[model samples]
Target: MGVYNVHERLLVARSGEVGALLDTLSSGGDGDALWPHRSWPPMRLDRPLAPGAAGGHGPVRYTVTTYVPSAWVRFAFSGPRGFHGFHEYVVLPVDEERTVLRHTLAMNTGGPARLTWPLVWRPLHDALLEDSLDRAERACTGAVAHPARRGAYTRLLRRLLRRPPGVTGKP
Candidate 1:
């Protein structure tokens, strides 16, 4: 099953500023000042963000398939068991004082992902992207005008992950 996911945020900075910050983050910089409040495994690339570069943590992995400085970037999945496709980030200038930062994921899930995606991955994915956008906004404007909030499902999942295995209260 193919999944197309998109998340965007309007920043007070121009495309160049926001794009530069994103580039820094993607390059594994020490700029925790603009850190995204991520609930999922953080992305770590083996090299700077560029074509053919590869990275990802946890159940996700991909290779940089396309890159355009200060504008856009694309990554093609190479792992995570059943993810086949790409994701990208684009910085669009709304005007000199505004920019739109968009992140898009287009991929087909197979094997267990078909089930895990809908039942588990989707919520986490959405939350992650929203947080990413929030971080981008903070990076540009020095504040998160509207921080991303996790839905009930995401909160519940977090609780479950913290539980001890085989400790189910019900028989």
Candidate 2:
């Protein structure tokens, strides 16, 4: 792998219970509620996802976008500029009820995207990965008790869930 390769893997949910969660992860996230009074705008979808892209390939593709609000958020990058990267997740069936999600994130620095991370983003990469995945777990947990979606929160969640990602819904 190239130095550009940075990864984070977490077993938050069982192999079987992660399908919907995987869908939500690859799709995007809603920050309005989480941020509440913060000025951070809603999470946007540069791309919407479809289901079935479970293996090396899926029946469809999904993609989502997010940005760090404060420069001090501490993550893949915690410097003057924030870190922005797109994540792809693949949801696979481990057993009847177990599904394995493999997540992969790609970020570019210095060379392009008008983006750059601190010189040692690798050290902090794992922490950021864990944080993002933990948040995803929270969303998935709510989906279980919550109705499919009844209000504005559900509306945004739906938007995120719809983007199944062309790649595995792992991340």
Candidate 3:
């Protein structure tokens, strides 16, 4: 069981604006310009973002466990085995012109996660979150000093995963 948290502060946007940005991502993904940098898989909920709503992307399935409008939302994983916990987004206001956005993943990895987490999941997660925050910053400030770039490791992992399993690693 491990509790992992990641966050970003929007120094140039208001709480409502940041909330709306997050809502846009939650509802329809970040589109082409920002898709690759999302912290979470492109979510596609069957219903609206609210408590008890069910949805997932890729290999993950979850049910919304909590929702507090533009402030917070949590989803509890229901599949992929050994993953028992929830991931959530929280929005906190720093001032009338600034906001803090956070994402938290708290779970107990039982089966493969214990191993996969350290070797693969953690690295990918960190990269993705930082990239997502970079996009957020760009959205708020109209520019970012340094943009996120997928490195060799991330690219290799993506390529490997895209290959059909047990294919002798030839692609």
Highest TM-score model number = 1
Query: How much lDDT does each candidate structure score?
Result: 0.77, 0.36, 0.70
TM-score per candidate, in order?
A: 0.85, 0.37, 0.80
* lDDT top scorer: 1
TM-score of candidate 2 to 2 decimals? 0.37
Pick by TM-score: 1 or 3, better one: 1
Clashes of each: 0, 24, 0
**Superposed model 2: Cα runs more than 4 Å off:** 4-17, 25-43, 50-87, 106-125, 139-171
Model 1, range 1-171, lDDT digits (tens) per residue? 989988888888988898786676454435532335245555777887778788774557888898887788888998778888888888899999999999898989999889988888788778878877887887688788888899999988767755367664311
Q: How does candidate 1 fare on TM-score? A: 0.85
